[model samples]
Target chain A: MTTQEDIRSTTADRHGFSEVGPDDTEAYVELQQSLAFTRLRSRSRRYLVSMAALFLAVFAGIVALMSWTSEPQGGSSVAGIDLTLVLAAGLLVLPCVVTVIHLVYTRRRLDPLAEIVRAQFERSRR
Target chain B: MIFSLIILLVVSRLGRARDTCSDFYVGDRTFTSRQNGLALFGTFTMMTSFVSLSDQIAWHGRRGVLLAAGFAVSWLVTLLLVAEPLRNTGRYTLGDALSLRMRARPVRMAAGTVTLVVSFLYMTIQLVAASNLLALLLGLDGAAARPLIILTIAGLTATTVYYTGMRGTTWTQIINAALLLTAVLVLAGALLVYYRFDVARLFGEAVGGATTSGRDLSGPAPTGHRSPQPLEMSSQVLTVMVGHAVLPYLFIRFLTVPGTRDVRRSVSWAIWLITPYYLLIVLIGFGAAALVRPGGLLASPDQHSPVVALLAVELGGVPMRMFVASVVFTTIVAVTAGLALVTAASFTRDIQLNLTDRRDGGERHEVSVARRAVVVICLLLAGVAILFVDANLTFLMSLDVTMAASSIFPALLFAWFWRRFNTVGALCCLYGGVAVTLALVTFSPAVSGDPLALFPGADFAYLPWRHVGLVSIPASFLLGYLGAVVSSERNDAKYAVMQVRALTGIGAAEAVTTSPALAAADGEPGAPRSRRWLPRQRRQH
Candidate 1:
C-alpha cells in the first residue's frame, strides 16, 4: 500500500550506497554504471549466451543426427548397439557436460569479476 | 509405508507451532543449501520422471531416452538462467519478483492465476499417476479400488501440506528423494551386475529385443515404424527443457534458500543428483527392455508404467516389487505435497492478498487462508484425478510444462533483464503467453487428430506439432518486446534498483528482514536492519 515515493525512499534507504547517500535513483544507476559491474555484467552476459548456444547446438545436433538415420530396423550400430541408441546415450550425458563447463567458467571467469564488483561497491560506500 | 507416514506427521506437527506466513510459505527461510537441494531434487523429479519416463523408454526406445535427457537438461537451464537472480529478487513467489518493478496487484493476480492452473494440472497428473502406479504395485485392477487409492493419496498429500506447510514438505521431500535415489541405484546396480557391468551388452540386448519383438524401436508409437519428425522431437525437447525452468513448484524453490551462494549450491546439488539419476533411468529403461518379457512389459497400454515393477520382479521378486512400490508411493506423496504447498502459497500470498485491500494482520490471515487452500486444492485434485483415472494424462504433463515455459519464463526473463519491460508488457507476456499456448494446444495433435491424443474421436487438430512450446516460447518473448514498445511506461530507475539487487544481492535481504508480516509476527516492528541476513560462512569467504 505504500506510495511510489515511499517505495523509492525505502529502496534507497535499504541500499544506502555510500557515494549515492540518500538518493534512491542514483544508488542503482551509480552501481550499474560502475566499471567493475559493467565488466562483470558483460562477461556474465557473454558466458550465458555462449553456454546456451553450446547446449542448444549439442542438443540439436543429437536430435538431428538421430532423425537423419532413423532407418526401418535400427539405423546403424557402433559396436553391437544402434547408432541412435549411442547418440541417445550421448544425449543423456549432455547436461552433465554442459553443467560442468558452466560451473568451471563461472568459477574461473565470472566469480572473480563478481567479487571485483562487490569490492567496488563496498569501497564506494566508504 | 506406515512408518514413514508417522515420521512425516511428526515433522509436520512440530512445525505447526509456528503459524506465521513466512514459516508457512518457506520455512522462515532457514533451510540449508543441502536440505533445500534435496527438496528441489524431490520436487523436480516427480512420479513422471521416476516411473513414466523409464516406462516410456522401455516401450518407446529413443524417444523415451530423449525425454529423460530433456528432464535432466531442465536442471541445467535452472542452474544457468534462473536460480541466482531469482533468489536475489523474489521473497516468496515469482509474483513478488515481478511486482518489484511493475504495478503489484495485477501482476500478482496474473502470475497467481497461472501458477494455480499449472499447479492444479500437475497435481492432478501426479495424483492419477500415483494411484495408477500404486494400483499396479498392489495388483489392484478394479475400478472400485482406484478411487480408494486416489483418496488415500490425496489425504496424505493434504495432511502433509496442511499441517506442516513448507517445513514439513521439505523434510518429506528430502527423505523421499534419498529413498528414490537409493531405489534407482539399487535397481540400476542390479541391472549392471546382471550384465556383468557391460553396458554395451545391455544396449545390444535392448536393440535385439526391440527388433525381434517387431516394435517401433525409435519412436513412441508401439505399432508404427517411423521416427518422430525432427521438428516434433525438437519441439518436445524444447518444451521440457525451457518449460521446466519456470515450473512454479520448481521456481519457488529458488526462494527458500537464504542467499545467492546457497541458491547456486542447491541448484548445483540438484543438477549433480539429477544427471546421474537420468543416466541410471536410461539404463533401467534399457534393462527393462532387455530383461523383462515383452508380453509382461507391454501387456496393456495402461501397463506401460509397470516396467520398473516388472523389472524388479525379474531381478528379485515380490519383496523387490514391494520395495520399489513403496519408494514410488513416497515419491508421489512428497511431490504432491510440494505442489499443494505452492498452489496454496500462490492463492493466499499472490491472489487473495493482492486482490484485497486489507492490511491488518495480513500475515496471520494469509497463513489461515493458505491452510484452507491446501485442503480445497487437494480435494479438487482428488476429484479431477478420479475423473481422469482412465484417460491418458502424459499429454497433460507436457502441457503444464509448456504453459509454464511460455508464460512465466518469458515474463520473468524480461522483467529481470529488460529495463523497458513495464506493467503492460509483463501483463501482455503473462496473459498473452498463456493464451497463445492454450490456443495452440487446443489445435495441436495432442488434443485431437492423433490416435493417442486426449480426444481421439475428434479430428479438428490444426497444429501439426504436439507441443506448443516451440511456437509459444518464441511468441511470448516477442510479445514481451512488442508490449513494452507499445507502452509509454518506463521504469529505468526501478529497473536500476532491481538490476543491482538481482545481480549483487545488495538490498535483497531487506525484502525478507523487513517484511511487514514477518516483522509483526516476530513482534519486531522496528527491528534494525542487519547484515546477519547474509550467509555468515559465505560472507567470511
Candidate 2:
C-alpha cells in the first residue's frame, strides 16, 4: 500500500505543481498550534463523540425552536402554508439537524480527508 | 472583549513579521477545506445576510424568498460548477484563476480592475452596514458612529496585515463562523419565545390578516394570490443580485484553502450555514410580519426597518442587546479580516504576480508590497464606500460574477470535461457572454427593475438568463466551443492534461514546478520573490 506521503509525491510530480503540505501554509501551521483548526491527536474517543453530540444537540435545539416556535405573520405560502411548517420541522429543520450531526461525525472521521486534499491537490498541480 | 484583544495583541507580538510582508496574502498555501471554508463563510456573511435579509423579511413578507432563491442558487452554482475547476486552475488569487487560460494582457488587466472595483464596492457596502448597525444598536449618532466604525475597520484590517497575514484571516473567519452560528440561533430562539409559536395557527394568521391587514399591505396577501403578480421580476432580480454580489468575497475565500475539494466542500458547508441562517431570517421575517413593517426598499434596515427597532426597542433587554452587539461586532471583524486578506492576495498573487513576474521577486519584497497594498486597498474601499454610502455598488459588481459564472464558468467547465475545447473558443464565449451580461444590466432596464418581482416571464433584471438554468449556461459553452473550433488555435492537450492531474490530486500544486505558469519563487519562508525575477537587464541603469 502506498503511504500518503508517497501518494503526495507521485501526485505532485504529475501536475507540474509544487509541494504544499500542512506545513506549507503558515496559517495552517499557526492554526494547528492553536486548538481551533487542529484535530484531536490523542483524545479518548469519548471526548470526540461527546463534542460531536453537543454540536448535534445545539443544532437540534435551534431546529426545534424554529419549527416549534416562531408564529407565522399571516397567511399560507403555498396553497397550504401549514405544510411548510411540517416540512420545515420535519424536512428542512430536521434534515438540517441530521445533516449537521452527520457532517460533524463525518468531518471527525474524515480527518484523513486532509490527505485526500493533499493527494488531490498534488494530482491537480501536475 | 479583552480575550479577543489579547489574542490579537499576542499574535501581533509573535515577532513573525511586523509587515506581514510575505505571508500576508496567500499564507504558506497549506490551508484545508474546513479551515478555509469557515473563513470564506465568515467573510461572506455580509450585510446581505447578517442585516439585510432579516430586514428583507419585514420588507417583503414571504416574498423575501425571492432573494433567498437568488442567493442560494448562486452559491450552489459556485459549489458545483466553479469551485473545483477554480482550484485546479488557479494559484494565489482570483485574478490569477481568471487570467490563466487567457494570455491577453488587456484581459488580465481588465480582470484585475474588475476585482479591485468589485472588492472595494462590496467592502464599502458592508462598512455602511457596520456604521448603521452600531448607531442603531448602540444608540450612537451617525456622526459618532461612522468615524468610530471606520477606524475600527481600518485598524482590524491593518492588524490582520501585521499578523499571520492571510492565515490570520482564516483564524478570524473561524471565530466569525462560530459567532455567527451562535447569534443567529439565539435570535431565532428569541423570536420563537416572543411568538409563543403555534406552527399552524401562525400560518393561518398570516394568511388571514397579519401580512396584509393594513392599507399598506399591498392588497390582500392572505387572499391566496396563487400566481405571483407575474411582474417579470426574474431577470431584474437576477441582474441586480448578480451585479451586487459574486466577485471579491468568494475569490478572496479561495486563498484560504488547500485546494479544489476544499473549495467545493467548504462552499457547500457555507450553503448549509447560510441557508439555515437565512431560514432564521425567515424566522425573523415572520417575526417582523407579526411585529412590524419595513419602509423604503434597499434602505438601511438596521434603522429604518422595524425589525431592528423591535428587537432593540421592545422587551428582553440586556441579554439580547449584548448578544446582538457581540454578534455584529464579530461579524464586522471576521468580514474585515477576510476582505483584507483577499485584497492583499489579489494584489500579490494576481496583479503583482503577473505584473512583476512572481518567479524573481523577493519574498520580503512581495510581502511588503502586499502589506502596503492591503493598506491602500482597505483605505480605497473605505473611501469609495463612504462616497457611495447607499449606492450598493456591490450589487452592480456582483453581476460580473454571475456573468462570469454562467458564461465563463460553463466554458471553463467544458475545458475540464471536454478534450475538444480550444482556448480561442473559450475566450470568445467567455468574453462575449460577459459583454452581453454587462450590456443588459447596464444599458437595459433590467438593471432598473426589481429582479424579485412576480414572475420569470416578465423578468426585468439585466442578466440575459434570469432564473432558468436550462438555456443560458449551455449557450455560453456552445459559443465558446464554436469560437475555438472556428479559430486555428490548438487544443492545448498539455494544459488540459495538467489541469486534470491537478484537480485529481495526482499532483500537489504547492510543489515547485518547472511550468513557466507558476511564477512564485521558493526559499526562505514568508518571503515574496516575484520582483527579484524581473529580468535584471530591463531595470534602468
Name the 10 consecutive residues with the lowest summed lDDT in model 2 chain B: B532-541
CAPRI grade of model 1: acceptable
**lDDT tens digits by residue: candidate 2, B432-472:** 66665565455333344443322324535544332322334
Question: Candidates' DockQ values?
Answer: 0.35, 0.06
On lDDT, the candidate that comes out on top is 1
Q: lDDT for model 2, on a 0 to 1 scale?
A: 0.51
lDDT of 1 at B234: 75
- Index of the highest-DockQ prediction: 1
Q: Tell me which residue pairs clash in candidate 1.
A: none
lDDT of 1 by residue, A1-126 (tens): 223553354343211111222354465577788887888788888888888888888887877777665674455678766777778778877777877787778778876776666665566555
Q: What is the lDDT of residue B497 in candidate 1?
A: 68
For each candidate in turn, the interface RMSD (Å) is 5.6, 12.9
